[model samples]
Target: MPGSGANKTHAVVEGGSIFIQKLNSSLWAEANEKKILLGQLISMYSELLKTIFKNKRSKHVKDIIAALEVYKTHYSDGMKKAEELLQLAKLPMNDAKIELKAIMELRTVLLEMNKEEVRRKRRSRAQNPRGRPNLSG
Candidate 1:
């Protein structure tokens, strides 16, 4: 009865352009956040590599750092591309496909970074059975 009418209203709003635009905006915000996070991770990895090299250098750590730098560049480029796509999506034509493509690309990059992060964590955990260093202490 009342709930059914409310559900219908919800469906109407969800199907409209305003809802789509809002969703796209949210995706854009998430992409930007991911880009910032990637930058921070790159900086941290670089610092770790520097500390490692100062004491005992390992080819594995150097390789991981190199890979992370490449991912950072890729993620940055994806963020720029997403911004351009957002501008294009706002044009009169209002093509949702462009926005969708941009979101998909960003998601792909995010997935790649997540996978690499998991791998790095696994390797670190394996190397240190005691687990990650406690920064709080």
Candidate 2:
């Protein structure tokens, strides 16, 4: 969210702006739907993690968390890296001096989000059966 999306916009412009380029209407629609599905999956995973922690159900949390991690790496991270590569390739970066201002800002945001995620998880589970500090309270 820090990049102002200007770079992506610029990259889109420079890269022939494929956002509107028709790649078989049906296929495009399918891809868009899949992206939305991935978003929903992320949300569902988050909710599941919250519920598992709230209920103190540790039996299968690791498996679900592992699946979520793989999903992000395979689906989300791959898309992001591809987008960055596409943007860099489209722009005429002289002598490989590509300005990754956008990606760096994005990385910062992701790191912050990761930290917040850990905090949230910890806070959600702070109230254990054993006498521990209850973040919720």
Ten residues in sequence with the least summed lDDT for candidate 1: 19-28
Candidate 1 residue pairs in clash (backbone atoms < 3 Å): none
For candidate 1, the per-residue lDDT at 66 reads 85
TM-score (all chains, Cα) for each model = 0.31, 0.29
Worst 10 contiguous positions by lDDT, candidate 2: 17-26
The lDDT of model 2 is 0.64
On the 0 to 100 scale, the lDDT of residue 49 in model 2 is 89
Q: Write the per-residue lDDT of candidate 1 for residues 1-137, one digit (tens) a residue.
A: 66697898998787876433643564446655656545555656677787768777688877887887787676766556556767967765456876677677897889999999999899878777687675653
Q: Please report how far candidate 1 places residue 52 from its true position, in Å.
A: 2.9
TM-score of 2: 0.29
Top model number, TM-score? 1
